[model samples]
Target: MRLTWIHPEDLIGHELRQARQDGRAVEAIARRWHDAGGHDAPPMAGASPEPAPERLRRLAEDLLDELATIPSPLADREPTGLDAVISACPDWPGAPLAAPGPDLAGRLRGAWAGRAAGCVLGKPVEKIPREGIRAIAEATGNWPIRGWFTARGLPDDVAERWPWNRRSAPTSLAENIDGTPEDDDLNFPMLALALLERYGTGFGTDDVAQMWLDELPAGRIFTAERVALRNLLVGLASPETAVYRNPFREWIGALIRADVYGWVNPGDPARAAVLAHRDAALSHTANGVYGAMFAAALAAMSLTANGPEEVLAGALRVVPPESRLAVAVREAADLARAEGDFERVLDALHARHADLHWVHSVNNAAAVAAALVHGAGDFSASVTSVVSAGWDTDSDGATVGSVAGGLLGADGIPDQWTAPLHNRVASTLTGFNGATFDTLAARTHALVQETSG
Candidate 1:
């Protein structure tokens, strides 16, 4: 059977027409776009008629007004650490031992497990409705399929299944089910794997930056904001031109790609945060950089400890206390304490901030909160909460999952999640392969040893 693929632009146009037929104004359309992290469409070159700036501005205002009215449930509270269950686990690994040694391998493994946990948590709920997600959690006795890994290994049927794209229907823009090209080009775990494979221990900051630049297609250029941020890093020259400015939210994908920096640094969460911040500043600003710092710090801490709460605390210390991301995480934790229902908090958040762009500080802030609170040291729950919450599902899932996987270690991941995936992941970008998660984890461990030594 031949497959039919519909372009995103066509889908957008169809939605707009349907909304218009239903008597919805352009403002409503604009609001939906903003909520989905989209900006106004750029004018097509050589078009004779163009939208008047004043008209577009009015549409933008209407959309903004509609957005301002929606209230988010978990937007107001302060950042709280994981619950007593996670804090009290006797087996929870503590902070890494100081300095250069073999212990780093264990830490890296923990961080990898954390990442895996995040992925597993989000995987099942990637595009499922909120109600459906809640129902699944209730039925499974686990909010997002947590902790089923047996040291003895997988059941025969599951172990024999081959990993490949199984979805049979056309995809919606909101749901890139099979992780096609249209999905965001880079995710945290994939980027970490790439960095480790490419830079390894011998490359310094400059070499890493150059390699990243080289990796991009020749016709594509880094934005001025990215350049400015890159200049802030170690060994990169600070350009006098000032031509570059920060992209802030638009470059979040690039910012979260800093986990490898932390992985390389091992026990030095602070250093990892610094390197992540410097790298992130090249393409992002404010919370964008902080998100990278948070992920990187967790990855770094994971190198030394398996305690999710402690690793999270280490990450929190690195970001600015007053930032929106910090505020959102704290609020989510508080909501988790006061309200037992995770969906209610998510509802509240949507009501308050649904109009905000998906990549904006507030949106990403909610993602962080969802991952930290829902996951609460349980790998699956964390990933599920964030991914099911929607918005940037893959990006959030990848980051949170990677961090959780790192903390939990590969051995801790349930066979169910990994068994179906068979450790395969794909990116059109070079220097990556469709390898098993075990192989990737082992390679990552080796890289840490090489870098720290």
Candidate 2:
């Protein structure tokens, strides 16, 4: 049986695509793989196929090492070091003092609840494309997706055509949700909270790696994280762990882990971004690292900004302007403002980013940016729009929710959205399963105070 992400043959296929994206000279490597009868990686999540022969696996390892040494043509524009990243951004805003609003507790509660709510909302349709989501929702009379997705009234034809994500359907559907169900989107934040509690605000990448080994189950990780863990188990350190044979180094994994960093820093986008970058470097690079910084900075700005536009503007300052992630985010936000209709904006975004993998940081971050800008501070609207964009649905939804939640505060989010969460979250990480959002928020609030003091 094939292990989903760690197999060298599968990994090499994805690495080739990543190499091509970053402008590496990989024509010879591609030819070698094709000549040896190797296949490209499948696009869907958690795909497992029969393993390639030992000879091919060995060849794949050699090819991956060669690909790594060839620097991307865009390397100068998209530096991975924190100092280099900040240097590339002309508008780098230094850290802000903690300036939380009067209802800091309430906003924290809202942020956590909103994350759980949005994550659960998107869970059932995690891998479904936008067209499939629309078809399934329309058939069930929930076209705009204002609430939890239900399999209850979904027509049999539509169900077969766009099946619910198998793991999520059992616990995430409207009829089945008891509380926040387990998702990597939620688990990563829990880990962040733990990291802060254990090591304070000065935690390093090594602390993050140790936190994962101590709390995060091996089976629970996926994509870049899974590969990073594999490297860690073999005695490799971070930065190296992130790069070695990890084709998913630029995917959405690190972005999903960023919210709590922002939560701890509150109004300080630069500080939050720095914290996020340290954690992100454990499993990602360049665009992937920038995606984490963007999300953290976005979450930080949400705590004190007046609107989505202000929040976005502040968040964009942390990312290097010329990086692909930054470019996509700017383009997406521009399209969102120009086009009043969300469907039209999505059409343009999908067309523009057609080359990017669905779960790649650039495309999904674009979706998150567009959703927030277009949602215009409405909690339901922002979460739904991002989820509907259909790439890394739960991850985007959770991020949009965190920002909107902080911006609106708990009272501002509609009862229809928050009530279903039942004030609780579930996770595979130690001590977080069945934890209440209120408790998590309280702990996060304490961290803010600790950091500020």
Q: Highest lDDT, which number?
A: 2
- In terms of lDDT, the poorest run of 10 residues in model 2 is 42-51
After superposing candidate 1, which stretches have Cα over 4 Å from the reference?
Answer: 1-209, 217-251
Over the stretch 39-127, how does candidate 2's per-residue lDDT look in tens digits? 88877854446778899989999999999999888999999998899899998876584488788888888888888888888889988
Number of backbone clashes in candidate 1: 44
- Per-candidate Cα lDDT values, in order, are 0.49, 0.90
Task: Tell me the TM-score of model 1.
Answer: 0.60
Colliding residue pairs in candidate 2: none
Best by TM-score: 2
TM-score of each: 0.60, 0.98
Q: Candidate 1 on 33-93: residue-level lDDT in tens?
A: 5665544332211112333345443554444344334433322221112222123223333
